[model samples]
Target: MNAHQSLSRRRMLGLAALGAAALAGQSTITAAPRAAAAPAAGVSDGTFVPAVVVGTGYGAAVSALRLGEAGVSTLMLEMGRLWNQPGPDGDVFCGMLQPDKRSSWFKTRTEAPLGSFLWLDVANRDIEPYAGVLDRVNFDQMSVYVGRGVGGGSLVNGGMAVTPRRSYFEEVLPQVDADEMYSTYFPRANSGLRVKNIDRGWFEQTEWYTYARVGREQAAKAGVGTTFVPNVYDWDYMRREADGTVPRSALTAEVIYGNNHGKVSLDKSYLAAALGTGNVVIETLHQVKTIRQRSDGTYLLTVEQKDDGGKLLATKEISCRHLFLGAGSLGSTELLLRARETGTLANLNSEIGGGWGPNGNVMTARANHVWNPTGARQSSIPALGIDDWDNPDHPVFAEIAPMPAGLETWVSLYLAITKNPERGTFVYDAAKDRADLRWTREQNAPAVAAAKSLFDRINKANTTMYRYDLFGKRLKAFADDFCYHPLGGCVLGRATDNYGRVTGYKNLYVTDGSLIPGSIGVNPFVTITALAERNVERIIREDVKDSHRD
Candidate 1:
């Protein structure tokens, strides 16, 4: 079977696991045994939980849900605030077209990782201090864009829920059980994330996807095949959006900030279900600073609560029998590196901050001819990708991204995922209290070359050239300074055991994108979720349950 067919079959079988009750938006999941009183608010409360999961991203959400389901009371600590409340402007997130301070964290001026039109510092705007949905973490050469609020990257990403090619999976994670991953955890993650493909019939007819169709046609003309990318957005709602029967999100230029509708983010899926268990508590804006093991084998965490202005409110000491780090790639890596540097976790594996990669992300735009007419009515959720990963020399899977500039710009944008083998390392800087990535822009050359090889073919076939206007100034076309998908840092089998159990420390786990060693050739969240699903099950069965029995 082709990739599309295989994906369909997997989706069908996974949906079968969502029994009638869950399909009807009802829960049959029973609450697990409570470990202690729900997580306390103050330091003096002497609070403790059975397990503490850091961050509110995919891995954290999955671990929290699974641990709660297994009767292991869990507490999740997030550095960013919960983004469920609408501001005075009547929206929880700011749109990408008009980004304000709500687009960034603790900054009076907004810093969008993507530079403005003509690279003229015009995209960002100033606003009052508030906890935004997106954060642009700047390093020496790379700027990583990550979501900061309750849903994490789901709050800002394109909602593309893609599984990496199985063959590539084996090559990247050689020790992982490929059969079990494809047959079990991958489908489970897709089903839980509410992933769905766009209706092909609607895609063919909708004006919103004309840009994508043009992209496919151009790619086909260049002998490059295109595939429909699956996403976590609700397809039925998107269909209604096209028919003018519902309020639009994907059609209304709603990505890279947060989708107000049609997107089934983690907040609506796993995290919501976890809360229903009553054994999971999430403390937003509580950032874990230091971690040290107590004499009794429990872990002690020093957490600082911060307000919207990034001001510290209180520092609390909390203890947990088990600690799971799910604070994405950068956050988790920094926490561990800091602990190691300060001698808190002295014997942490030497590979703690190694094997980091940006998933070979490169963004560029093609200036289509006026006759091509890339549409003004464009969907924000990309539904197509030019699949060129089979190319042995320059493998590239380029997503047909939306310009969504609210007008016909005749620009075909692409975010190409390439296979670059370069890896970087992170080091803790004592002076700044930050973790610095040693990756240089020069290391991104391979990724750019891979992307250019494919796009150059399309450009040649179509008699079009790169859109120098979309990216920053100068003749350079590819945007290589930033990455939306930051993978690795604390890699599997290196920093941790195969099951994500950190070596030298019992009950310490790493369950985020940090576990991915370098590139995965596709979006990392699904893989992170599946891996967490696999590891947490074993941990509960072999570790948690055994300890309780003992």
Candidate 2:
């Protein structure tokens, strides 16, 4: 009963938005109200539960909350710590400029996407292996970025709560009802996630957003239409940070690893709301290894409890009546692929590891003119994007990312989501006990080309060129290798039914980004949350009518 346990008990599992708003000078934003967890009937070690959710991400949070509201007892398993306890720096998370062991997931060094600046290895740092927040899972040709904590990807993403265009959403996921999504679920998801826009008047005058202003002006030079993107970071709190009234997290560069304050991550939003339901509980540092069916239509999961140093503590057997996999595209897909290949869940269809894509992700930077100094002081929170998705030839929504290197680097960074038709596949490797991505470098050619088509025009019109030296000495302008938005591995219609029910398994569900087919032409979390909201609502109403009979 120390500080960490006390915090969890009082705040509802990592203190959700209530504590976050309080830390941000009592900001108006807050998550679901805190309700004491209902006393468990008997859920404990080697015990049974009415429902079990794997991963505490957007989907898992939604599922747990909805199920709890429907009077179901649910348990959530996460591979990382609660992240509520502060470290020696008096912060729960370390900053990007001076990252520590908390920046990486059991890696000896921090792997920043911008590996270097001016051909110098200044971004990444050597660190000790720990069960930290951000994790980079390297496959043969692609490196997938994932968040390793209770809040999942919400802890590490850019906080861009973007809802995809209705046309694009219909094109990617035709099975989903577009009318319900755009009209109902999208707004509901935005409200739950607390998405907000920065004031345009503040944007014009603040030095913090000068980087985005320059990006917008540069895109305008190429006749490209730039739009302001909404984010989960508190705009009012950010204004205070810029004014030096509040603690600096986004302004002083606190992203990629984790944000200390102002960011309304899932631990404070959906997950917090889920915890407030009193029927849900989360167990951290527990990784599910295998999934097998019990004799009486129950699911048996072989889970490992580990310490932050990667020490195996115990292996436990837990059974659940219903199982929801919300461990993102990579984690959720691998579990099913392994179960299928190893003959555990033999009925799983061939689509378990198919229709996987990188969402046409490509990262590139432009060498801005010396006259247009893109501000020495910048906020890590992105607020603008060059929207060229209407172009029929190569649709792209490029987020004008900030190069928060704590100095005026004279660079305009972007992470472009292109409409490339290319997709990848995942193959389970029996020897390594892992699912290996079959995506090769050649597969990324179309993605790079689509991004180049848009950026080339900007370069030509602005009389600038690509920053070849940023990505190391190879002179690769576009970073087509690694991707942040990893969608589709267990695709929606192909891998499961229209409502995300597993094709051959009755009580199995896929509720994360694995449902989308490769590309969505925007930041994916909002779409993921909305789709989860839609799916879980139907599930609680139709599937679990008698779930509480016990």
Candidate 3:
């Protein structure tokens, strides 16, 4: 192999070894330990704990950490793998251009958001079914893209950590106190997540972010202003990547699958701290199938322990005095809906499956003029956004996304978060024993129109046109079918109480994207983390510490 390739190989091997050792040596809480499916015959599984958190995403991690810090013994259940060890290629994750079985969740082929390029299906690849990092849960009209590992969505997202405008936040959740969220919880979430911003001086000169600059310039041509967005990816490490000072992850198109370096996922931040508190334990490859309340006021969960190949190893039952459903929008909503439908948790409110939306997500690409060539070297981490949210007509915050094909495709892609009032809901499908989203393509009309409104202005000024070949053979430009930010389903004020307490149950709580109603006007991770911080702080103060029931 070449010298650079050989060096990268050795570096990845060393990292994998260190990660394995760290996981193995977390008894005193050195690093976050991810226990494999089921232990040996004599070992006692974590079948019961003082508290159980049912996810490892932004909100779940926050809840776990706070509970652990509050001295509550907590067990976190994650369905996906830990994703710390290197694979056959000596890397934790595969890049976008070349994906493997590790790119998707139990699917025979990868389901990349960008399904096609130049009308060719060059984005996806067929592989064996395995528990991969990213999962595109397809419904009738909407497909929700979620991460599926120890750190959950943090493992697969673009790492854009954005807080919504206060006015819009009030509009979405008026019940939430804005002063506290802005002053205390938001900063706390930012600190815990290690959110950082790219240096504008470096951003201006770096070849890696040329696409963002191009996007900004094009948007400015139409009088639409752009704003810098914060992210969890280490900006300094990204600059070093551009300078060839370290092995590349973002520069090599490693997003949507996972990032090996630079990015600070929840496992590296909150989950690690939760483990360090010596009160949190994370069990991977354990999926919660159903949840019910016991007669004595405790909650019981029917968990399925499985291997990476979808082989069911054991059907186990776990119980907790306090239960937190921090699973992503789909997983948590489905579990509660199933429980309610099966008469297990009969007191679960009707709002458990209502108020679902895709954060008004719409993706479109522009064929830039040959002269305005976006650079071939692009960072997968998005750093810029078109800040038109204040526009009273059709508010939108369109992020300048990277088309990191490792070559110039002459395409400026955008994933716009529009303020569409349309929302979807989930219904219990008894035959399949799952919650199905009752959303139609017609509901996305407002999002498409809002996106077209902004892009049309840009296209008019730049004399550019939309790329019709990117989404499919329908000659459509706006991709409204899939969304990266899947919000709602167990909405805060509607499905759960103001503090994430379930409306009908005592010790059950909802703490994820499911708490948000529809749109967040930007990326939802920071808001999710902050809201979780707000909710769990109150929860721990009132419920866990004092044994107060909601």
Candidate 4:
């Protein structure tokens, strides 16, 4: 048999055994409840219980784990399956893992299509209407990526763990005490995600290393001063590369789609722990379509459950005393916006869909002629960054993350994080059951100019360092596109209060990328996770207490 067939057979056997073991102590396992399944007509007479989290992405996972730890019972509802098996695509490799197109585990049910590196397939889709007047600017020019599964984007994201610049954090989330967040939330997220730097030893042998080394050298010569940063991955796997036990091919640059190794997604971290708590239960393949608040302050959720082929199986209503919206920015915003626009929840304020931004993210690639082989593979870890962000003269918050070496024909790729003030709008589409997002340049003139000018300088500097071309002579080629790091939409101060409490809605909270008020000038997952941690903790300590008194 071919390698894939053999691997599939072995995996099936292992899963069967695991199923037997799990069923040994329990009765027959019924197919999990479908969100579309009908529910009993009457309101639940059962006592209003503690909060139930209705999503299992990063925000939901962290919130569920923290709530469970705090002795609160939570039921997490996920629309996608848990990624426990090696993805169907044999492309599952180690360091800098990328998405395997062959993986049966990957789902394309929603309208938002994704490509390799979890980048949005903008060419295939049109911009949503509420995205404002920018819809006419050719959304095909933009690329935004999102993940849908047990761990959400954490599963498909490049495992770069960067703490936002301290100054930027204070400015945007000014209500949050930076000292407390840095000391408490940041470290907590890093530890939970198993964040670490790429060991310099193992990366030396890989071709992907050549790209990063050349990029860093070119940036430094240009006076950008790039450095490696920490990542959420297993250091031991990297050590094995050093020992030659694992091949450089094993660390294939397949990040963004999904990684077989190297980085730790939520499935292995927060979700795993939450599952172990026994107090927390997760139901996958359940999509929440709408939410209604009862007179007694309880939440009734209408969900649609789908079969493997994406057919609607059933619909059901679930009631919970507390509802946590941890669906990523797109998913959560879509749900809220639909509910508001459709008059399903008309009481929501005008701020429900305001303050959207793409975190000013742009993806630009630079080429280097002489491949700097020294520690190239090990340097895949982004240990360096540029401080051009905070300069009042430039006023752009930006950083560069290392791209895997050897993937491209030339030297390296760096994801430039600029403070692009460009804002996008997220509107609900009931017919499509998705968010129509539109990003425009007319509203983002400064951000657009800044992105072009910064890359122009980098391109000019690369000429001095090496003999390769940069950006293909396209001055503003990359701005109209987007990276996977989407932020805002349901911003903190706008859609919800400072503590993530939605205005005019009690006992309902939002915790996810949706809570970010605006662009954070960095990869947003770490910030999202940290913010969820802080918000959940506050709810347990403050909101729950207030509820008790009431």
Give the runs in model 2 whose Cα sits over 4 Å from its true position. Answer: 1-44
Task: Give the lowest summed-lDDT range of ten residues in model 3.
Answer: 35-44
How many steric overlaps are in each model, in order? Answer: 0, 2, 0, 30
Runs off by more than 4 Å, candidate 3: 1-46, 546-550
- Checking candidate 1 for backbone clashes, the offending pairs are none
Write down the worst ten-residue block by lDDT for model 2.
25-34
State the number of backbone clashes in model 2: 2
lDDT of 1 by residue, 10-64 (tens): 3343223223223343212123324554454322325877788999899998998
Rank ordering of all candidates by TM-score, starting from the highest: 2, 3, 1, 4
For candidate 1, the lDDT comes to: 0.83
CA lDDT for candidate 3? 0.86
Give candidate 2's error at residue 94 in angstroms.
Answer: 0.7
Candidate 1 error regions (>4 Å):
1-45, 546-550
Per-candidate TM-scores read 0.92, 0.94, 0.93, 0.78
For each candidate, the alpha-carbon lDDT, in order, equals 0.83, 0.85, 0.86, 0.60
Per-residue lDDT over 1-550 for candidate 3, one digit per residue giving the tens place of the 0 to 100 score: 8733543343344334336644663211223323332122211344666788999999999998888667677778888887887787989899999999999999999888888887889999998899999998988878889899888999998999898999999999999999999999999899888889889999998888889999999999999999999999999998888888999999999989999889999877787777655556777788899888889999888888888888988888887888999998998899989999999989888888888899999999999989998989999999999999888888999999999988888899999999989989999999988889999999999999999999999999999999999997678899999999889899998888899999888989999999999888889999999999999999998889934221
* Model 4 bad stretches (over 4 Å): 1-49, 87-141, 200-208, 246-250, 370-383, 395-408, 430-433, 443-445, 464-476, 545-550
Residue 214, candidate 1: Cα error in Å is: 1.0
Residue pairs of candidate 3 with colliding backbone atoms: none
